[model samples]
Target: MPYSRLKNLWGGTKSLGKLKVIILSHSQQLVEVDELSEACGLEKIDLQGCSSLKSIPHTDQLKNLQLLNLSGCTRIKRTEVEKKIKGLDQEGGLKETKSESMMFSTLAVKLEPGDNTETY
Candidate 1:
């Protein structure tokens, strides 16, 4: 779906049933995904390159979520994302696995200064 112009994921999108994955990569204008938590079955959410995105919904309710790609999201703070994910892990929301943990770590590393220049 074309989400390049999307600013947020509110309203009707929360009602989508059986949505397993949503890739809104490079949606430069996107700033929020507050209603995304309603998609409990989501396994992957790729928001890579969404430079303007500032925050995502809490993951405590997304028990099935496996991959959450926030690479290149320059506007978001790595520490904040890590805090939220760590809380989710403690709550048994995301499935705990070495590779999954590594994925988040790598994404956090990529958020460092000068690392946001990669284009889609």
Candidate 2:
């Protein structure tokens, strides 16, 4: 098993306050997953190839999140995450983030070109 990117990253420090990106591809573990929400400046998160990872914590607090990669998290059910994402979108949570511009293009959900956002 490979080293955990997260554990290795914060090993030298007790806290990571402004973490922006975390790429944990193929890491042995993705523990403390909920800690992501604590980082206020979190942007892109890459969990590609983390086959051991099953479910991901809802990250509505990570309003700055731009990209998310769960391609290799075979255990993760997209339907579950879609529901959470939908909830966040409805509350104008994710839409306020900078990555909102890429949400429609990247995710299955689509925001019409001229449609009123309030009703979307």
Candidate 3:
């Protein structure tokens, strides 16, 4: 439908070696999907805005992807994410569940507070 934000994005001519995670909140552009898939080498992708994004690209290529946040993304499919999650789960891989999934009141997965400390 709209082709304004997708201009000169997914050309696939860049090498993203240092990227780890990608958070596309309120970015309603489709042209960058492929480019992002190629550039970020992203392990965690948070698509919070794209309500029209129904498909995901290059799942096999993103072997390092762990957590995918699609909280507000109603249009995006869950099967792709589910498949990835299942694969990771089977292999005994670990993922950082977000604050919505778990309630720690401080951190999601003890990112700062270690096990030896008690804040009661």
Highest lDDT, which number? 1
lDDT of 1: 0.61
Q: What TM-score does candidate 3 reach?
A: 0.50
How high is the lDDT of residue 109 in model 3?
16
lDDT, each prediction: 0.61, 0.49, 0.44
lDDT of 1 at 67: 69
The TM-score values for the models, in the order shown, are: 0.66, 0.56, 0.50
Better of 2 and 3 by lDDT: 2
Q: Estimate, for each residue in 1-120, the C-alpha lDDT of model 2 and write its tens digit.
A: 234654333443335467788767677466435555567566666766665665565555656665666554555554445543422332322222242221211232222322322333
**Model 1 per-residue lDDT at 8:** 79
lDDT of 3 at 47: 56
Comparing candidate 1 with candidate 2, which one achieves the higher TM-score?
Answer: 1
Model 3: per-residue lDDT, tens digit, 17-115?
567776665556642365555643566666554555555554455556555544444444334444323233222222334421211111111111112
Q: Worst 10-residue stretch by lDDT in candidate 1?
A: 111-120
Instruction: Determine which window of 10 residues in candidate 3 has minimal summed lDDT.
Output: 102-111
